[model samples]
Target: MVKSFMTLAVLVLSAAGVYAQDIIQVQGTTPDLYVMHTVKKGETLYSLGRTFSLPIKDIAAENNISADKGLQLGQNIKIPLNGANFSQKADAASGGAPLYHKVEAAETLYRLSLNHNKVPLDNIRKWNNMSGDGLKKDTYVIIGYLKGGSGAVAHTPTPTPAPTPAPAPVNNTPAPAPVNNTPAPVSNNNPAPPIENNTPAPTPAPTPTPAPAETKPVASSGSSFESLYMQQTSNGKNATTEKGPGGWFKSNAAAGKYYALHNTAQRGTIIKVTNPLNGKYIYAKVLETIPQIKGNAGLIIKLSDSALEALGTNDPKFYCELSYEN
Candidate 1:
C-alpha cells in the first residue's frame, strides 16, 4: 500500500546544520489558535505536550485522536494555543522558544501581524532583522514564541506546486417542449339549433375552512446573558465603562452565547456591550485582548459576528459602549 502525506509549510530549524521536526502551520482565531505539527519517529502525545507547552489531553482533543494510541510517522496534528502556551508580549523572548510563521503568497507584513495575534510590526522586523515591509514568498518569520518550550526552531523553505485550474461545467439533458391545452374556438359560420332542457345546475361547493396561521418560534435576542451580567455588577465592585468604536470577528459560538476580545479586559471577563444608536445590549465573555493591529486601533472591543448581529447592526465598525468588571 502507498502512503499519502498532507503537504503544508513545514517549520524547521537551521542553526549550525541542525534540523528538527516539521511545524506545518498556524490556524484558527484568537483563544482558539493552533500550530500544525507533523509527527515523527519516537514522538508521542506526552512529548508534543512538552514541546508546545500544551496539556497532553488538549493536543489529543484538538486532533480528535486517542491519547493511548501511538501517533503514526508523518501524521499531522494541531497543537492548541491558549494564554498558558502562547505569548506575543515583549517579554516572550525571555520565557519561551520562538515559533516561526512561513510567509505565503500575497501576504503583507501588516496582515501577517494581524493573523498572528497582532504582534507589533516593529517587533516582527526586529526579530527577523528586516528593514523593509516587503516579504518574499516562502520566507519564515518569527511571529511569536511558544511558552515553556526548550528548543529554538527556525524554518526551512520547501517548494509548493501551483494550484490546478477548475474544470468547465457541462450540460447533458435538454429541456422538454411546451404543450398547448386551450380548446379550438367555436366556428361562427355554422349555428347549431337550441336544445330543449339542461340538467339542474350542481349545488355550489362549500368554501374551504381556513387553516390556522403558522406560529414560527422567534429567535432569542440574547437576553439570557443579562442574568450573568447583573450578578457580576450587583455590588458594582471593580466595574469600568467605556464608549468607542466597536468591531467584530468570526466565531462558531452557539446562538445567544456571545464572546468578545478587549485589550484591557482579562480572559473570561463578562462585558456588557451596548449599541447606543438603537439602545440594544448583550453580555459577552472576553476571549483575549484584541490584536493591536492598525485596523483595530482606537477600537474598544471586538465582538463575535453573531453578537454584532444581535446588537442590530451590520456595519463592520459601529459606535458602542462597554461596561465590565476590571
Candidate 2:
C-alpha cells in the first residue's frame, strides 16, 4: 500500500512540472544549496543563465569557471539557487538613481545633456566624477539618475540612411553617325616564310607558384575582460533579470582581425565572448551596436566571420556568453 501511494505521489509531482535540482551530495549529505548540471553537447552558460533567470556572471562565479574559462561538454557546473544581488560600486546616491553613458567622439558635457533630454551639465559632471569638460573615446560616464523611478536610460542616435546610387546615364547623345571607315581586308596573301623548328627544344621547368600569406590570429583579451568585469561589477550591481547574450550571429560587414556587432554595448568597447561548448573564448571590439530588427528576439550579439573563427569555429551560428568591462 505504501509503495503504491509513493508511486502515485511521484506521478502527481511530475504532472505538476516539479523538477528537482540534481545536486551532488557529499557522503549522502547536501551541503551547499545549489544544483549540479552536466554540460550538454551544445548547451552554453548563456543558455543556462537564461534558464535559471540569473546573470551569466553569477553562474560563472558559482561554478568556479572564470568567464574566460568557458564551459565544456560533459563538465559539471553549479547553479546557485539563490537570488542575485548587484549594486553599483561608486555611483549610488540617496536622492536619485544613476544613468550609464559611453563617451562618443567629441562628446562634451553640454552636448551629452542635450542628447540625454537636457539633464543639466552640472548634474552630469557631479554624477560621473568629471572635473574637466573633456571626454574620451570609449569611456563610460554615469549620467544623473532619476528620482522615484528606476534608472533606465533612454537615448537612440538616428541611423544614417545609406546613400542611394544614381542610375547610369543613357548615352543618348547620338553616336556620331557611324563614320563609314571600313578597312578592307587585303586579298593578296604573300606566301609566309617557311616556319623553322627551334634547334634545341628542352621542356622548361614549370614555374613555381608563390605560397599564400599566412594570417596570424589576433591576440584576444578574454582573460582581462573576464577578470576585470567580474571584479568591477561584483559588488552592488542591478539585480534585475534581463535577457542575457546568447547565440552569436555571423556577419562580414564589420570584418576585421577582432570585431563584433553588439546590440547594446558602446562602440569601441572590448567584450569577452566564450563558446561554452568548447571552452574557447575570444575578446572582440564592438564595431557597432546593431539596430533592432524584427523577429530578432533572444539574439544577443553578432560577430564577424574572422572573429568567430579566431574563437574556435566558423559555423553559421553558435551559443556564447558575454563579459565586458562596465
Q: Which prediction has the highest lDDT against the true structure? A: 1
Q: Report, for every candidate in turn, its global Cα lDDT versus the true structure.
A: 0.69, 0.51
Q: Write down the lDDT that model 1 would get.
A: 0.69
User: For candidate 1, lDDT tens digit of each residue in 1-326?
Assistant: 12222222122213323434434345665556777777777778888877777788888888998999999988888777778888777667777666677678977665687677767666787766676567778767777777886453332323331111111222322322222222234444335533222423433333343433432222223565666666777745657899999999875456688878888886667898878877777889776788788999989999988999988899989999888885
RMSD of each: 20.9, 26.7
- Which one is best on TM-score? 1
Per-residue error for 208 in candidate 2, Å, reads: 48
- Candidate 1 Cα errors over 4 Å, as ranges: 1-25, 28-32, 152-326
lDDT tens per residue, model 2, 220-298: 5445434544454463161112234444443322223355667667666566676766766666666555546654566
